[model samples]
Structure formats: C-alpha cells, structure tokens
Target: MERRKGTIVNVGSITALAPGPWAGVYSASKAALHALSDSLRVELKSFGINVMTVAPGGTKSNLGNSSAAKYDQTHDWKYYKKYEEGLRARTEISQGPGSTPAEELAKKVVASVLKKNPPAWFAYGQFSAILSVLYYAPLWFRDYFYRLVMKC
Candidate 1:
C-alpha cells in the first residue's frame, strides 16, 4: 500500500513450475503470475512494499472433486475420449491424503507475512518437492517425466 508500505503476496500453483499436457493454460496463467510477482518485487522495493510469491503444491480441499464434476459436466471430448480417464485423474490428483492441509498452509503463509523480512519466494505443500525436482531437471528429462506421469 502507498500509505503503509505493506506486502503484496501472490498465490500461484506448483503446476507453473513446468509446462505439461492437460493443464497448459492453467500452468501458463500461474507462470505469468509468478513472473509478475518477481517483477513487482523489484519495482516495489523502493516503495518499501515487499512482494512475495507463494506456489502451493497441493493443499487439502474439494478442488479435485469439483474440477472432476465440472469437467465431466461441461466437456464431451470426442477425439480425446481415450485420454478422459487420465484427465479426470489429473483433476483429483491434488486432493489426496498426501496434500498439505489448507489450514497448515494458511498458518505458514501468515507467519511468513508477519515476519520483518519475509521470504521473496515460498513453496510448500504436497508434491512440492517432486515438482521442484521436475523443475530443475533437464528439459528432456522433464518431458519424459511428464509423459510417464501424465500419460501424455
């Protein structure tokens, strides 16, 4: 804020770490947000407004089921019908037991925000570690990994 010189936090998704099949648009949007946050972090530094980007991997929520339901209701894939099962599975992949609790992520984010020197980049929750690995892997390896896991 101009008055108080507060922090700006942008919440992105771990999916933005890599561009893969099935969720390309979503990934691109999140990726754009991350980029914007990075730029803002520098541009707003002089104003004493800290910018932080949080890329949550998978927090516990009903998102998976809701996504599946919406996809099933709205999309009737004629040519890509063969990949329907895989697509559906992708929607629910993050709502499993391995996901970090929403409350836990909230607490961590709040704690970080309250800190005098909050982290510029923070990533937490399930699938975050593996996703980071994928992000750092070579392009070829990342492609292979996604092909294998996403059934692309």
Candidate 2:
C-alpha cells in the first residue's frame, strides 16, 4: 500500500513505561520500539503513512508457559539465589486471571487500525492502567511498590 498510503502498527509492551523486576532487557527493547515509533511517525508523515504504537499490557496466551518451559531455573546465582522463586514467577505473571484475552485485544487493535483516523498510541490489556499509574508515580513509590509486589 505504499502508493495508497498505509498505517504501520508497532506492537510494544506496557512494561516499557515502568519496568519492574526480572524484565529489564525486555522492557528496554520495548521502550526502544516505542521511541522508534515516535520518530517514524514524524519521519513518515509526509509519505502518507500513519504510525501507531500499540502497547499491550498482559494478554492471555501461552507466552508464560512457553517461557517457563524454556527457562532453566536451575541456574545457581551467586547473590540473587534467594530471589529465584520471584524470577521464576515472572515468566507466568502475565498469564494471571486478570490478563486480557488475546483474541479480544486483537479485535480491538484491528478495529482501531482500520479507523479513518487511528490513534497514534493505543494501550490495552491487564495491568495496563496500573502500569500507566506507576509510570507517573514517584521513583521511591514505584521502587517500593515493585519490591513489595515482585519480591525483588
């Protein structure tokens, strides 16, 4: 659709806004994607292309199971061994009951992208709002809350 102008939808993660424990690399990657999307929106505007950044929170899927299955929790850490359970739990945390259904999120994203004037940023899924709140919260508050909840 280069000639007709098209929308470029980039899927990111809500964790990019406020990274917590055991997911620093994942969060940083998503954050970089978000930043790239922002830049692309400006750079591609004259080309009749729309850039949208969709930051999903936690949607139900096999991600947790796959991660848990592939992860080797047997690794012996020198100092962070005490937090092993917490690290292991990170793989399954997004699969909790509160996660949004993957199909539901997909439908919403499709509808949004098809709109005549799609939003530049769309975020949905479980913990989406809470993470947004944490993004705006004070550093100390975020640190304490993440420590309490993640046990890291």
Candidate 3:
C-alpha cells in the first residue's frame, strides 16, 4: 500500500456484478475485491489516493483459453456437453474474436487514468456493453439468459 502513490486501479470482471454458472467462484472472489476497492477508495481519500475499479469485459488473454482446455481434458463434461457449442462460444471471448484488441484496451485504460478527474468506475468492450445491461436485468431474466447463451 505504501509503495504506490496517486491512483490504484483494481481489475475486476463484469461478472462480479452478475455471475454465470461456469465461473461462480471466480466471480464471487472478484466481487469481494470490488467491494474492497470501493471501501479503500473512501478510506484513503484523505491520503490523496485515487482508487478506481476497472470492470473489464472479456479482454483477449491466454489464461481463459488455457483453463477451458484444461477443463476439456480433465472435466467430464458429460452433462455440460449438452451445451458444448454454447460453452465454446462463451469461452472464446477471453481468447478474443480479433475485433477489440488488447492493446486498444490497454490504451483506453491508460487514457482513463491519465485524466485529471477520472471516473470512479469504467467499463469497455462488447461484453462490457452486454454486461452493463445484464447487471440491471431481473434475476429470472439473467437465469434465462445464461440458459439461452450457455444453452443449458
């Protein structure tokens, strides 16, 4: 905490606000961090700390693909296989569709931080758009959504 000065950006997922079945635990942990970020922003305000939480949508990264691969190898998705196509589509976002580049995301993040009066919360990308809307929808709607998109 002492090592850094100025702003502290905590990376969270859009799923932190609203979770899906495939990553319930991951979303919960991120939600915890999101709460912590909110708390610290208030606590450290007197000390001139600018805390911002970046709820990045699905950015292109190798980690998600690797996890999916591992799951394929070890997870007996006998049940989930029913939703195999949907699962593949959902997981592919983390691996990217080549539409929104990672470098572009980084640039936007950097630009946001560089602002003198930066937003306390910021989101970007296609999944961000989808998530922002989904975050407000009714629970049943969201459930139906997961079933539809995940094809469960």
Root-mean-square deviation of each candidate, in angstroms? 1.5, 1.7, 2.3
Q: How far in Å is the alpha carbon of 106 misplaced in model 2?
A: 0.6
TM-score (C-alpha, index-matched) for candidate 2: 0.92
| Ranking of all candidate structures by their TM-score, best first | 1, 2, 3
TM of each candidate vs. truth: 0.92, 0.92, 0.87
Alpha-carbon deviation at 27 in model 1, angstroms = 0.8
- Note the Cα lDDT for every prediction shown: 0.87, 0.90, 0.80
In the predicted model 3, the residue pairs found to clash are: none
Tens digit of lDDT per residue, candidate 1, span 44-139? 988899999999988878877787887656656676678877788688788877888899999999999989999999999998888888888999
Please provide, for model 2 over 12-116, each residue's C-alpha lDDT reduced to its tens digit, 9 standing for 90 to 100. Answer: 999999999989999999999999999999998888899999999998889788877655644556466688788777878889888889999999999999999
Best-to-worst ranking by lDDT: 2, 1, 3
Q: Where does model 2 exceed 4 Å of error?
A: 1-4, 77-79
Worst 10 residues of 1 by lDDT: 71-80
Which 10-residue window of candidate 2 scores lowest in summed lDDT?
70-79
Candidate 3 C-alpha lDDT tens digits along 20-118: 877778899989989999999999887778888988888777867776686577557887777777767766756666435678888998999989977
